[model samples]
Target: MRRMRTWCERFLRKRSSRAWFLTESNRIACVKRMGLEAAGAMSRSPSAKRHTSSVSLKILVDMDGVLCDFEAYLLEQFRSKFPDEPFIPVSERNTFYAHEQYGSIKVELKRNITDIMSSPGFFASLRPISNAVTCMHWMRDIPDVSVWICTSPINKYRNCVSEKYQWVEKHLGFEWTKRVIMCKDKTLIKGDYLIDDRPMIHGEEQFKPNFGKHVVFTQPYNCNVTTEWRLSLWPERKDKLLDFIMFLREGLAFRD
Candidate 1:
């Protein structure tokens, strides 16, 4: 009995060490011992399953630049608020961020721009990009396509967060307000395609392990970026958008 207990204790210690190591092979073995299928263990993982023919094509659309004329509105508000302060025209914008462009002229100008953006009703008052609303409605009506507004609220979330919901409600309708996903790290969100104006969604320091194909929404700021899935004009270039969606669907179907 003493020898058997010693053998059991040694076996348990070895098992504990393997568990502590947590290697991929050890994890699988441990899971199997626990009576769980190794494959089934990660059934709920984001990248576990690819979209089959029956599965809807999930497309994540950005709010500010893609849906609404964020830069135009910001310029208008900045000019109205600070008439004398120098401003960069929308056409002349090169950098991804508006404040970065203003920083070159005057350091204090960054704060001015920030104040305008973070102010209440700023997002709500912004006008929709030409044909953006119409296109959104059209996309929503497409069969087997799931559209979602994936946006990030400014750091000054006090007014920015609530106003974003209001803006969506006002423009995209009340139902779309529910589709709004205010996330800081968009990489975590799972979608087949992400239509965004920004060149890099998750910034430089972080690794963006997103499963979606980034469809760069053409803007003066991100004009330098060259992507096959670039969306320039809404409704007019909507054919290209449809083509991309169909291509992805066919590819996924073939893969499945």
Candidate 2:
């Protein structure tokens, strides 16, 4: 463990100087390799194994709006593709689905919206929301918290599915790609908290009960949702979010 720590420190120092020269994949590979090596060394130590066993909190974060600027990117793509078409601005959007907002408008407009969404590279090209990546890393580093990306792909899965994985790998690193859960029915998944922008998450005929608390990740559309826990700003309100998670963790322990 000592040797591994020493090597990691030295490696970090070396990488810090030339980080700009390294490609995204290469940088991710280097960091992942070091993490695995350190984890392997720690696993051999009795104290580390005990510490690992204590981790219990599971945080399931939604990808599209929570992590990436999905709506913003979609709007941009829609505008660029169909220049003259009437479209609802992001601020004016009142529904979770963008296409729903265009229902009263031209049928061609709605089809154009869907086309933009189903297009190849649309999901992969979305920019990460400001401070979202940083906040995710912070959450993952929390001793007891286990952060996982729980996202639903569009019904047009051909492009949406592969691009979602690529997006995670490109932005959050390859290690996080393994943590991606591409399931339509999120209520079936178990976790301590689920941060999502959708006002209603339903499965099949009715809305199923989620095992975890649904912490609304605020967006223009979901502003109407009345939830006790909501994350409107990243990093800025992250401390309060942590407090909420910890409070729940303690409450669960007390119940036990």
Candidate 3:
């Protein structure tokens, strides 16, 4: 029975890979979520030892929009600093540029960075977005699912990652087993999936060829939207963040 089960799994994996032109691996989420108990029981039930390989889903999640709401925090900071400044929607950028209305724009400055560092409450008040916890839970439930947080480290801002990690610990209530990397090139580091907002950094195919799918968390400033896979952070948005993640899980598979 043990050998037969192994053979069956190998056969199924091969079939799935060939069907989708994907590489063969035991990263199937369903297998991990559903079959672990049975696999364990068969091995210890005085029956033949089951040779079932535990499937682990590997995910590389982006820190800012996917895991936390950094953009909204920035926006709030901007508004607080310059309440009188006229609101210029991110979509209106082209018009603002053409009209040379750059003066009305509120940019996050060095002082704002300092403010973020100095104020504990400012950082503490930053709550994760609506589906952030759910996303984390999904990754946790998977036996083999490991989430490596990838974020672009602001070159001048060395302490950015430190604050972010502290926030993550406060929110997650535990240290992450998978390490977090503060890197300029997220795609260069290996992972099955990348959840990020910046297309210019992680969007390039060179950095993410092996990724099953790249997930972009939506924002007003990130106005240039792409249809391949994206989710808006807005409460009333059409695609919930979870919806996009589920789509990736069901539709995509990593390949060599």
lDDT of each: 0.70, 0.71, 0.51
Clashes of 2: 0
- Cα lDDT of model 3 by residue, 92-205, tens digit: 433212113333343444355445534545544566888676567655654445677777645445456567677667877556624677667665667666666665454455
* Candidate 2 segments whose C-alpha is farther than 4 A from its true place: 1-55, 204-208, 236-241, 248-256
Q: Give per-residue CA lDDT, model 2, range 27-46, as digits (tens).
A: 24333544464345333442
Better of 2 and 3 by TM-score: 2
- lDDT score for residue 14 of model 3: 46
Q: What TM-score does model 3 achieve against the real structure? A: 0.58
Task: In candidate 2, list every pair of residues with a backbone clash.
Answer: none
Query: How many clashes (backbone N, Cα, C below 3 Å) per candidate?
Result: 0, 0, 1
Q: Which ten residues in a row have the lowest lDDT in candidate 1?
A: 44-53
Q: Give the distance in Å from residue 150's predicted Cα in candidate 2 to where it truly belongs.
A: 0.4
State which candidate has the highest lDDT.
2
Each model's TM-score, in the order given? 0.73, 0.73, 0.58
